[model samples]
Target: MQVNKRPYGYEEQTMFAIMAQILLIGFGLVNTGWTQTDFFPEETQLKTAFTNTPIEVCGRVVDQNGFPIENCIVCLTCGVATSTRADGTFILSNAIRSNQLLTVTALGFYPEIIPVELYLPTNRLAVELPPIILWPSNGNVIRFLFGGDTAFARRMLDPLERAARNEFPIENPDALISVSNPLPGTLRVVSYVKPFFLYVDYPIINFESVVTLDPSTPHWEKDYVYFTLPGSLPAIKTLNIDYVGLGNNHVYDYLESG
Candidate 1:
């Protein structure tokens, strides 16, 4: 029996075919930029794992009340989002900047973003966060008007009907609002609050001026500041100033007295 050795080119042709197929596959992988998890698990973990960051956190989710909210999703920076246990307990460990915000989002609850340092400190501290109250998002979302930085210097407003109005799509809004330093004046500044209140659900203004006879001054920077009288404050309710916003700028106007 003679051994057959007739194919000289066949071996080289087979090897070349195999090499061509491999080259095609390599080019495809290069274009797509896919990592091989089987070969290098550590590198893949480094790229995709949010848990690898150096902050450890645990917290409970609750309503406005003290009751625990089950199955709420708590999320943090670096994509470290997770679901809470039945007891509203959640744990996450990853390193994100203290200045970054931690977001806790859930269905039927308003998404809230608090500073990451509030929960997980940038100093790599482990913290058990206080139960966060999830505000309801699914109720009747009434759109109300809110204005900022309004300082009415004893000025009466023109009527909404006569004062060339912009055609707003004011449907059934919950309220109309003007905020920060609009005090009720001697000439019926509250007149403005009533018509808007009659048209909508409620009309609200933030009375920044103190209804007081006290002449003590916190206005060290300027002598031009004035406070409304106590008698005038009754006009605040009489004209239907439905709500008041006591923000920092208003409260700081008279310092502790304010």
Candidate 2:
């Protein structure tokens, strides 16, 4: 057999070419103003995935007379539960953008449910909700239900688009596509536990994506993976979420503009 040798710089040249091609593609993506809708035609009209940045939720719990309620349990229905400090303040960290419910309860205070809509604010990852007021009450029974993150983007977009087109088996399919109703695909995604949410006094979740309507580019400089959801998605309201946590590292993937 004859011995054969490769070109001295063949591998280096090939690697250089690949890098150049990658740079060109990245340049095009940055300059062409390609949004999530462009790559997925089914999402053109849906306007989903605004930002998948993480954020934090913090707030103070107080009584009607503005007294700090210590040792109060402040928690999202899905997890990240915490007890308020002596100052009646609590911080829930590592929360993502989404709609959720917050359940607050103490020994002598009546439990209260607060709806949270997590979104990316300008240059901020910590969202401080307004002070929650709790009323004094005698012995009372309450119920709560918790769930984890609910995100509809990337791989989930196609199914959502199909559900929007009435391609799924659901009652009142039209409602799934309605802007004012729960998204069909989102409902389908949670159908197994949908009944649980309905029966609970407070249903909460950790929304893992920034919700926005602004058509903006991804934070290519800082993140390899980023996602966002349209603010108009009706599923947020229809799900009857009580709290949403917006604390995460990727919250600024779209810059302050998003």
Top candidate on lDDT is 2
TM-score for predicted model 1 compared with the true structure: 0.34
TM-score for each of the candidates? 0.34, 0.38
Q: Compose the digit string of candidate 2's lDDT tens values, residues 1-258.
A: 997987669889999988887898777743545555466666643334335456689999999899999999888756878999999999998675667778888987777778787756525778899999887764354556767655554335432333322122133434323232335666565654555576556777766554544425556565332343462356566667787766666566556765
Model 1, span 1-258: residue lDDT tens: 999996759889999988887898877743545566578878677554433446677888877666777778777655777888877778876545344556677677765556556333334557677788776765654324343343332222222323112121122212221222223243255553443343333555665554444536445664434344444455455544456776635445555664
Please report the candidate that would top TM-score against the real structure.
2
Candidate 1: stretches off by over 4 Å = 1-53, 118-124, 140-258
- Deviation (Å) of 78 in candidate 1: 3.0
Clash count list over all predictions: 5, 28
Steric clash pairs (candidate 1) = 53-94, 53-95, 54-94, 54-95, 55-94
Worst 10 residues of 2 by lDDT: 162-171
